[model samples]
Target chain A: MPIKSMYVTYSDSIYQFIYFLVGDDELAKDLTQETFLKAINSNPQFRGESSEKTWLSKIARNLVYDHFRRKRLLKFIPFLHEHEQIDYTYSPEQWLEAKNEQYELYEALGKLPHHYREAIVLRKIEQFSIKESAQILGWNEAKVKNATERGMKKMNELLGGERDA
Target chain B: MLDSKLRSLERKTLDEETKNSQLLKLNKRNKDYMKKQKFTYSVTLVLFGLLLFVFSQTITESPKSIQSQQLTNFELGEVTKAYYLYSKRADRMYNLTSPFYTDKIFTTDPAVLNEFELLFKNSEWLPFNGDLTKYTTSINYLFQLENGESVYLKEINEDGFFVNPNTMMQTKLAQQSHEQFVFYWMHIYMGKNEFPPWKIGLLTILLLIFVYAAIKSNKRGTIEKNSSLINLSGLGLAFFCIHKMNEWLGVNHLLTLLLIFTFFMSATVYLHILIKKQEPNWKYHIQRIFMANIVLFVLFI
Candidate 1:
């Protein structure tokens, strides 16, 4: 695909990925800009390896992991409460309904180990197949399936319900 | 129970956010790359120009003669009446009855040996015999003859032939008596003369300008300015002037003084820049220039 169309197609997905990982709108916007610049400058070997969207998302995920690792090393606690009051672009009624579910899920997800959360997100939310999720997370298919199952079981227990059929 | 909820939530939201974030990261990286490229190109151009200017200056200057003019005049017999005249036609064979000879008439005298001893002793009055075997001992000896003449002797060792010191001295004296007229004529042309003090002062001023310009060009960060090239050229010209002044004036001490001042000024500027982490100020620059001038003036005067 041409560079311009690839950027236009993947920009939103990359931004959304960073926003979910970091939970900050502004930082997500900055990271999205940085990810596209990297995509444009990267070698053409990327064209054969994966779809442009997947390649960009991988770069964004690496950046997000780096940010978290640095924060952990520096003992920084990001001010999450500051983001609680802002009105998102989505309507309040639709947002609140989704946000309540998101907030409860995020809380339960946060309680799980990082690997389980990542595997579950990639497998279920991103709707990647078992093999694709394994490839993205650098794990085998069985490990991804196990983490996804554990993450789902833990979330059901936290939400006071049985696992979804 | 809770694991299912987290899994469902991750499924619903992560795709949208990941796409949006990647775009933003790529944009920022591009800007940083462009800025770095510009800085690299500018530095390359400045270095190239400096190299070109240095090459052009070197090519334009004429090659200088290392042999002193006094030495040349002495060889030409322009000052002294005595000179060694070698003729391919007239005196190719031995002149068997010359007064300087203690040989058996014209036959090769094994006992008298060669006339090189008489020539070596009397070289002060003569020009060089131009023989490698005559100067087989020491190259830079002065021999004074009874005729109040002098000659400079250099020892040249021909293959396996050695001229002893006594014979070397005598050979040099005979050569000088024969070459005295030519040596004196060369001496008048080779007279040592001093450079005017004003010319040395002017060169010192020019060198100061170059040092000042180099400092200023570095400060502006655009040493791309042509004035910097001109200033550097001025420095080369000034150095040449100092060299010529030393030669003309026969003042070797002045060259040492100039070198010391140049070294100190360069070191001072380098240390100030490294330690302060800033460009040299005008006050320090001017003070260094003034100090260099004072040193130059004292040495030259």
Candidate 2:
């Protein structure tokens, strides 16, 4: 498919995926833009090895990892941490108005390690199948299943025993 | 269940206008990337062309001193002249055609002629400054050997050609007429004229500055993902080192060129992979490809 069509089809999912990974909306948008730019320039062939969404998710995941790496590097500076806070338009009031359970889940998700958070976001929130998540994460299906199970259990523990039915 | 709540939370998080605007921004970024890629490829091709041109020129003929026709056409009285030409059959030695002969003599051996042609193929006139005071008024036909040695064809005044010419003149002629002179002159010329130590030192300083800036910027996390300036500088340093190695080993012109071209092509491929796997930064990779080619041209040719 042409790059323009792919952008129209997958930009939101890619953006939302990045948003969940980084916990910042503007940065997510920037990374998503970078991801699609990389994809279009690479012009990867779709050989049906995995779905287009999985391929794009993999690219988006790698970009987020790069962002994390840069952040980790910058964390060494003492003053930089004081000045650098995650910038996003979402406010606590807006999250509460949307759904209290969802807001609590977002907070709980942010407390998880990157891998677990990614697993939960893809397998549960993004609704990717275990096999599809494995493809996107470059892992075997068993690993995806295990990570998702552990991630959900951790989320339950972090949310203070409120089981959202 | 938790899954249904997650599903409901994910739904309609972004409006149509936001998604469309995001796509528009992405489209602009892609266009910018393509433009950068196209520009890089063009620069690389141009550098390759320049390298090929210089490589061909270097091997075809060595640069010679420009000669004047005034001396060649002048007639001197009762002056016997002899042409010294290289002889390959005689173990690549200079054999003088008997001094009794007054006409010009040409050698049939290309290897022998090539050696002489490089040093004395062209000529220039220099004022006579030698101890021979009588010839001070006349101009000397000067041919500069690649090693910076000067050969002068001086006219005999009252005395015809001396019983034995100056040993320096004979040595100069013999050196120019030897096949070994080709390699010897090339080494001296390449070492002294092509790559001077001062120039290499300057390039080294420039490379260090580039590396330092890259490291500092990368550490601060202020570097843009698509920035290639550091990579281009690194490639330039690599080319300089390679060219220096070639000069030290005295590699043949054609082989040196082939090696440089191969190194550059491989580097280009590696950088291309980096660009594809990471951000779409084409400027530096392309600049590297182009700069390496141009450096090889300046170094070898």
Candidate 3:
């Protein structure tokens, strides 16, 4: 498929995956752009081992991991961004009933370890099959099953419910 | 709530305008990255070549010759003439020949030259018809007099050659001659006896600027290959400078070992930086490990 068509097809899924992985809209947008840019530049040889969605998700996941590595390194030198203020302006009044619940679910998702968060987001929210999630994560199917089960249990605890609905 | 909300969000997509703009930005960045890589590769090749030239010249040139010119071989004959003139020789000896001393001046001391002239007047210059295989630091010249036993001439520095009258006098004569050679090449170049504050300050400032630029460029998510290669060559040059300094200071074996260990530690860190920018494939892992070992081996040598 042409890159533009693929971007059109997959950009939302990719962005939402990154947004939940890291709880920031601007960062998710940046990483989404970076992910597509990497795909365009690398011209990866798609051997049909996984679907294009799985491939793009894998790229977006790697980009997010790279971003987190950089952030961890920056944390050592706090003085570098001393003047930059973090925005925390999301008021409860602005969020509708469903948006507020989704927001709380993501807040809990962001607290999970990267593997657990990725497994939960891919399986529960994105609703990818276990085999597909394993293909995207470059993991075996068994590991995906374990991470998803454990991740969903933890998410339930954090949300104070057995199920979201 | 989760399944319904996810279904509602699933319909969301970037608008056409935002998608087009992001594509445009990606294209621009890709072009810029390619241009930067081309520039970096060219600069790295040029800098590596220049460093190689400088390294070769440093090995060839005397440490003191940068500050003051040493007399050439043709001019060394002047010292011979001065020696004969001072000795008031009725007839100049034409057969006073040295094997490696053909053009290179052995000594500038008038007294030693006169003594050689006097010795030459009485004896025929038996050419040291021995092996003339020249080495970096010293040359051994062996000649036999017509009546006297053979004398071995060993030339070390510009003014530190010794004419041993016989095999028994070789060690003793060379020691005395070395003490009186009157040359301090190391002290002249490295300035161990004096410190130049301005030079040190200027060098430090330039180093700081180079490091700052490298760090800033690296943080922008582009690891220019040229900068890394330049750093690799710079590390080599640092190793060379430290070796020369060690020679100058008459450093002991233990200190040399310590300095070498520190250099290897730094080189390992630098190798890690070079490898970190590469793709994490099996080929990359093998290449990274291979290159690191090669770097450490080269530096150790």
TM-score per candidate? 0.34, 0.46, 0.40
Q: CA shift at A16, candidate 1, in angstroms?
A: 2.6
- Is 1 or 2 the stronger prediction by TM-score? 2
DockQ of each: 0.09, 0.22, 0.10
Interface RMSD of each: 16.0, 7.4, 8.3
Say which prediction, candidate 2 or candidate 3, comes out ahead on lDDT. 2
Q: Estimate, for each residue in B1-301, the C-alpha lDDT of model 2 and write its tens digit.
A: 6667667664324567767776787778777877877687778668878866665444333323334333322211121222321111111111222221111222234453344454433322233324543433321232334454433343334121211112212113333333353344344444444656777677767656666875664332223343476666666666665555443432354356566666776675666556544333455454455456545544653
Best by TM-score: 2
Second chain of candidate 2: TM-score? 0.39
> Model 1: runs farther than 4 Å from truth?
A43-47, A74-99, A163-165, B1-301
Kindly indicate the candidate among 1 and 3 with the higher lDDT. Answer: 3
Superposition error at B56 for model 2 (Å): 3.5
Better of 1 and 3 by DockQ: 3
* Residue-by-residue lDDT tens digits, candidate 2, A40-111: 655522334567788788878877766765776435555323312333233323545467666787777777
Task: Report the number of the highest-DockQ candidate.
Answer: 2
TM-score of chain A of each: 0.74, 0.82, 0.79
Give the true-contact fraction for every prediction, in order.
0.24, 0.31, 0.14
Q: Could you give the candidate ranking by TM-score, starting with the highest? A: 2, 3, 1
DockQ of 2: 0.22
Cα RMSD for candidates in order: 22.1, 13.4, 14.3
lDDT (10s digit) by residue, model 1, range B67-171 = 322232222121222222121111211221222211111112222212323322323332333453333233222323345544433323412121222223222
